[model samples]
Target: MSESITVAGVSVDTRHWIGGRRVASAGTFTDHSPIDGSAVGEIARGGPDEAEAAVGAARDAFPGWAATPRAERARILHAVADGVEKRTEELAIVETTDNGALLRSHRRGVMPRVAHNFRFFADWLLRLDHEDFETRGHTNHVSWDPAGPCVLITPWNAPLMLATWKVAPALAAGNTVVLKPAEWSPLTASLLADIAAEAGLPAGVLNVVQGYGSEIGDALTSHPDVRRISFTGSVPTARRIAASAAANLTPLSLELGGKSPLLVFADADLDLAVDLAVEQYDNAGQVCLAATRLLVEEPVVEEFTRRFTEKASALRQGDPRDEGTDIGPTIHPRQLEKIDGFVQRALAAGARAVIGGHRKDGQYYAPTLLTDVAQDSEIVQEEVFGPVLTLQTFTGEDEAVRLADDTRFGLAATVATGDRERAERVTARLVAGTVWVNCFFVRDLQAPFGGSRQSGVGREGGTWSFDFYCDLKNTVTAPEGWDQDHG
Candidate 1:
């Protein structure tokens, strides 16, 4: 039986969704909201056994689902999208409470994107192309085939959104999925399974196991039956999961940590540059693609810094449920400590805190900006994964591109320049999966999205997504009218 769990006054069934039903684990964990550390839900604490059950269920359902028509699969996904849209308000509130993001942002943007992920992939599946080439009197045909049970290990920052990013593609390809959402924010994931079932998704088609990565990551990834593993999280964790998947030779698509840069040039609109800089603090700076490092041209550094400081300082930080609040508390107490530690160490090493550099209130770290940071310093070199930005001055396009590409992580980057030619020139030199010239987070479903190096292993979006979730096959046919019986 499932138990009702309440977060931000939104109640959801918080039990593990396994084999099309809610199931409990041998133990339970109290999920707390970052707002005030109040217990929001008692959730299932899964272990190796739960992982095994979920994997087995998915394997059992794979053949039947794979044989189903793509149109039918699209239909079910759309229905799930409908369910997601209908419950957007409830889902957004729960996600805000569970993940510690602004309720307004989730309600207006994040949850809507969640529904769009499913709808886009659903219709895109119908447009999947097949190739038929005639060569040397023989016909060669190429098509995509669904891989078996996929293990989707999603991160906590954008729990439901990122999970659906992989889930939609995998399910659309007719592969069953076993999703393991991060333990930190799992309430919404449970609610997702409920929506899928209500939308008439077949039993065993979608399953979720709730547990710490240490307990279930290996068990899920190393399973011989698991064909694919898509993970989005830390570099260290990706290493561990990669090791486990290696034993089974399972294919992995890893979207790891990022330390992206936002380059501001002299020709850039100073007002727009400052606004985009402040926008990095969205989601309390937990965004992986946020331009944490601000590389500015020496000509306009002072004015840009002043405008950014004013806008950021005015940002309302409070309860996520409030419409006026721009940001909420960090997802956990330890996370707050980790964020402060990064700032404190950088300050000790001579980095100047422009406006904020410390805690504001309970679990709330202020929107922070640092100047006077060295290029090779730890603060600029690593992924802090907090609402902290570092500024460093450069002279020209070459230096700016050099600074942007300095980090090992390159998930995304932004170049704010008024010159069209300069935008193209610098963006090409900067090594990132996605780069925006004047805008920040302009996403298109058809574009390839991933990192150049340690940021991620494979791309996700459109055909790139299908490429990973499916296996491309070529079948060669004999010449027309050539029959063995006649011979």
Candidate 2:
């Protein structure tokens, strides 16, 4: 590995991990922490050359990794999960330093989910049934043949946890990967490479190249050998990636931005709805699956707003490393500016800021809530991606469904209701990939997780992930007696 240094008491490698070794780039860039504009570390500035090298390494590793026994792959994945669990706090601190998310959340939820990603996918892969049914006296079997080298382009918001969401299944399905992590939070990805290596993952099985998207991202996505591609980012960036990947007709799984809704009915428990609304401020509302658009029924709208604003107003915005900090800075000052623009525009359009309406100190945007927002306002339609929420009221269930499905995004959503029939009726009409009845971000690894429409192009999680990472095939054979007689 490259020279190691300490940041937040965690040792992180600042060079590219290509071919299972530290590879220096011709240039370098310094990652500045958003918390206080501190220089976090010097990261490699990878370009087309580095992207090609990493892809080549993954390409070379694919055949052997695919041919290896399934059990060995699962074993190695479990070991990596163990490594992640052991270093949970260390990883959490590094992630907080790099991305400005709450260290407590990373430790309590994100890192454990990372470990769970690997373990769940590992065991799930081993349990896939490969055999067949007798039809017309003929046996038909299936196989999830490993695709060739793959490219995983992930976003910066949640860093390692999101990267592993793609990496775990890609590796477990036996495809070597070249992961290009978002430059803003690239540190933990290098650390993840170390974890996989220490867990006995074969060389060239997973590679990380860090650089600006303009420099190396297109090259990585458009490479000839990259058989499958998965990207999680903004729609504009996804468009650019789609254009580049179109040259080779590479299949893509795009999980883009969301302005997902959280619906609260009149009969819903007011405290529960308020708590879930406050939870959106988690990660400073950087979550792609966050229910940023809250649609509350008119009967309880006033009470709901009172409780939500009080709770949201009380959220502590401070150093992410502090266990009690409920909200942290946006990833960068530019992001803070973007978030502020949304709040300003909404206020100018006569919307009321019931809670926070400005940036806190350096990079932290206040946990702002917008009320009296028009259904078609730009703030309602656009994704602010900060500690912000928009509240709207509907008179009836039909209007609630209409308002919820009105966004261009359909990533994920939340529903707070007391009636089972109402929950079922509403969820069926809502166009999100995942919906929670009364909770927020409760993920089942085995469930199909993805978005619809502009939110994303395809799904991941469970067999959906395997279907993308592997080339599924079905083979049919003649009856055993007939084949033997012919032979």
Candidate 3:
């Protein structure tokens, strides 16, 4: 039997997934498409009461899920990966419609990686090794155990993929989850719940609560039963979540936004640099790790800026569903306004716009390129998080390193240079969680992923993710007591 339900003339589910069922919500809220401002659907407006029930469900399911053998858990995770792969197109379309990501990018880049994340963690479970130590007269055994009920809050941009990043590892580590998807982009998460259930996730093992952060974020974060939390979003919201999680002394992993820098040296590969610079316009540049600050050597600054501006101007913005659309609408009207405001304020402060400096159509902002931006200007210091790129120049390696590390954010950076020594020296001094050498956004699931400083507080990838989602316990036993079945 199908639990498919529709609301507000949109064929979408508006229910919370609780206890392996699509549980009804106390209220509902409408979500509109950023592409055209049409009501995409109504989402369950989950609040404190709903959050409590979901946490209760997760808490009840935790012991059983944790007790399941590692092989069994691994099997279920593999099933989830299969399910995601089977419905790749469907998932891609839902994400595009709900979050305004280009259809091609979701289908080719994000959706495939969603399935890959699950598979990677499944494989990880099989290869997991615990810590062991030998003492003079005793043996110490250390193992990672599942934390109790957990709350995973995902941001609007790349909701499904980001949710998978937390959910896969948490489940692989044996933690039951209560996921709270951002209100502005809850449809794909609703679909994700369906897929997980269809993949044979046990009842109460995974739950979804869709609603405004203001109404339900605190409830989910501060819930007594939630032992761990992993959140991805703005710094302000992260601060609030940190405060709420502290009330119960719950553990938290926050992956906040970044004003990342991409540095290009005079001896760098200009072609590759231009290619990466143009990628700042990807997803309408609504990426936390997007290289918004372009710090180029003074000698090549003019050529790089001209080439980058031409590339930015060539990016076409239209319906996100279009196969050829290079740039799409931002998440919502407010974000579009915010992007324009950043450019306007920068222009007022003496920054000159080389290309697009305004909105193209309804909910669509033109791909913008700016130069002569001051180092201390808001545009450079703050994350624009839109299809806007600002250019700055540095005289040498010292100035480039100083300019790159000038912001409070230390999430990710890209260093493009032909010299291996230059890449090594520059990347070493760069204060970021992840640095790409001669490339950009090339993700490896096995590597540690997260940020430093104000960008984030914890890592989320491979072993780091397992460590965060599980609690390590040590048991020491005397050699005499360990004589049991020994030779």
Name the top TM-score candidate.
Answer: 1
- Give the candidate order by descending lDDT: 2, 1, 3
Q: Model 1: per-residue lDDT, tens digit, 293-362?
A: 9999998998998888888989999998898999888998889999999999999999999988999878
Error of 3 at 184 (Å): 1.0
Segments of candidate 2 deviating more than 4 angstroms: 480-487
What does candidate 2's lDDT look like per residue over 1-487, in tens digits? 2466688778888999999999988788889898899988788899999999999999899999999899999999999999999999899889889999988888888999999999999999989876588889888899999998889999999999899999999999999999999999999999999999999999999999999889999899889999999999999999999999999999999999899999999999999999999998888898888889999999999999888877777778899888788888899888999999999988999999888898778998888888899999998998889988999999888999999999898988899999999999999999998889988888788898888989999889898899999999989888654555563
lDDT score, candidate 3: 0.88
Best by lDDT: 2
Pairwise TM-score winner, candidates 1 and 2:
1
Candidate 3 TM-score, true structure as reference:
0.96
Please give the lDDT score at residue 464 for candidate 3: 87
TM-score winner between 1 and 3, please give it: 1
Model 2 clash tally, residue pairs: 0
The residue pairs found clashing in candidate 1 are none
Candidate 1, which segments miss by more than 4 Å at Cα?
A: 484-487
- Would you list the C-alpha lDDT of every candidate in the order shown? 0.91, 0.91, 0.88
